[model samples]
Target: MSIDQVIEQVQAVYGSWGRETTVAQMRADWDRLFGETVSPDSSQPVDADGVCAAWIDAPEIDRDRVLLYFHGGGFQVGSVRSHFDLMHRLSAAARCRVLAVDYRLAPEHIFPAALDDALSAYAWLLEQGVPATNIALAGDSAGGGLALSLLLQLREAGMALPASAAVMSAWTDMTASGESYQTRADSDPIHQRRMVLAMAGNYLGQQDASDPRVSPLFAELQGLPPLLLQVGDRETVLDDSRMFAHKAQAAGVAVQLQVYDAMIHVFQQFPQHLTQAQEAIAAVGQHLEAHWPPHSNPYNS
Candidate 1:
């Protein structure tokens, strides 16, 4: 299928967000869309320090290494079931197990709840005897921002950091102040400035939009792990990834920013439908594998 066709189908489902659509209905549609595409036969459910999660194991996966994944839905909708296929691809590509977390969502859990759940999952991994150096963090959209937020929280708390992290179409700025929100308004059919701000409002409520905990784009980014940021040029929040890359690089963090022309938000989620998605997801796997601890690197073995 072409990217245009994929976009059209996505817009069909996502376009109902504000048009008399309840959150429950939207959640069901979201899950049905992605869940129906991939079966969770290989997934093993687990309680990660009280947080709902699953171990997505690749065929012949190296159990020693893990890819901790968070799904994207503006922190309101997506789930482990929705992203099972994506996590499976990531697991196979990196030859590692994927710990996909079902973190608390917003308007009910509120700010800090998602972050707390993510932190709990990571800590649970450490407690399970997985070395910090053997883990990599990844997420898409809001979950991407949440991954970064978890990293920042870990760093600030003087905790051991993961080997590296990556984000695809990361909504790093809740302020929605990026220029691409306007520049790509016409090109991107999936999201707009109003929609972006509305999602932020749902997750953030009355919390400060610029808070580093919510907007990693506004945070002090020094001392974080190497980052791979993948974003589509046509996305409304394109600048969110671009600006975050610029800031993270200037703060002395290693950053690789790949901007795919004519792609949309979280395009990697559609590997079965788009060529760019295939390439981007493969690159993500390579990035994580390449950054693992030298002795534990799967490729080296």
Candidate 2:
């Protein structure tokens, strides 16, 4: 088996470590596995009076350019703690401070709650005098969907759009219409078909799955910022990214879709020891930096 398979097996083991395998149990195991993340340099907690966020500074630190980051946990279990290390690497490579948003999760907060928090955090950054042109948004898995949905909301509100966005393994289609959900169902190490359906049910509650805000894949994609979408060939949501990219292209959006062979969901979070993960994240950095050149930013220069 490949190293990715080994990693997936290990994660499957963790998924069963708890007594009942409840959402809480899986969360605890996931926390222990990826939550001991170290934030290099300084990290400042920002409440924005309501929205929870943290600023993970780059190794050299740049305040002018910012990346609004969202964490993935199926929209049910992740936090800044779980995605801190990934944000640190992104900040270092992008040469900007990353504002990691701690948005509300599902089954408790439901549909628009997470999206609300994300929009508020972006608004808060603008209130902080950060230029929208100097900021970008990024996330993985559920967080990736949230990031894209937020972009659509911003467009709907007639607000200034961010410079760019980078999404990793984004679950954009809540309807689960994508072919990969079946084609790669057995192959995807994480995100079982049944479990994902259950998670979606919990997140959407009485809401319609086709609501553009709920499943961004069905949303109108016009006039959004440039987008960088990366997904693993082994991802069950592979078609989620592919279909979304096609829609974005149809809408005249500049979108780059990169599919990594033999990788699993959100592999960029493993940049510490995984070569492909490192390259993927560095590509994210390159995408963002190309939009807001590192040298042009006085703080990074």
Candidate 3:
């Protein structure tokens, strides 16, 4: 199928999320649309402290390194199941294991709950003796923002940092302040300004929308690790990646930003039908490998 067809299907799924749609129904729809379809043998479930998660291994992988992943659902929907295929692809591309965290969602768990669970999983990884230098952080959309938020949290607490981080179409600004929201509105099939604000409000509850812990775009980004940010030029949140990359660079951090022409939000999620998606995932792998400790070559294992 072509990218247009994929966009139509996505719009169909998202359009069904009407005012009457229950959170449960939305969750199910999201899973049905993007959930795993292959055999479950490659993935093993685990409890990272109290946070539910799973470990996914590529057919051939470097056990020494890991990609700690978060799934995107505007912080209200999505699960490890929904994102298993993507995580598995990432494992293969990055040539490492992936610990996919099924973090709690909003209107039920709310703001800091998801962030807290992320911290818990990372801390659990550390407790298990996985050196921070052997780990990398990754996620898409809201989860992408969460990964960055976790990085900031770790830095502020003086905890060890991961080797690097990569985010795709990250929703870094919860305030819906990005100019792309308007400029790219006609081209983006699934998202708009109001929907963006609605998702943020549901996740934020009564919390301030501009809070850096939730909206990493507003945060002080000094001391963060090397970053690989990918966004579709057609995404309504395109500026989320652009603005965050600018800020990170200004903070004296190494940042690589790739804007895929004619792509949409989290386009990598549709790799099965999109060539650019495949190339983007491979780029993520290259970014991770380039930033890893020099002596740690996964292929030699």
Per-residue lDDT value at 119 in model 3: 99
Candidate 1, position 86, lDDT: 93
Candidate 2 C-alpha lDDT tens digits along 1-301: 4556557645775557544567776666666667665544346788964998887886675678999999988898887777888998999888888999989887788888899999999999899898899899999999999999999999999899999999999989888888898999888866777778888898998999889897999988989889999999988899999999999999999999999998888988777667899999999999998887555645652
lDDT of 3 by residue, 110-195 (tens): 88999999999999999999899999999999999999999999999999999999999998999989899999999998889999
Candidate of highest TM-score: 3
Per-residue lDDT tens digits for candidate 1, residues 1-301, read 9988988889888776677888888889999877886665658899998999999887866778889999999898999889999999998888889999999998788898999999999999999999999999999999999999999999999999999998999989999998888899999997899988988998887799999999999999999999999999999989999999999999999999999989998989888999899899899989998899654545321
Q: What are the clash counts of all predictions, listed in order?
A: 0, 0, 0
For candidate 1, the TM-score is 0.96
- Alpha-carbon TM-score of each model against the true structure: 0.96, 0.93, 0.97
Stretches > 4 Å off in candidate 3: 294-301
| Candidate order (lDDT) | 3, 1, 2
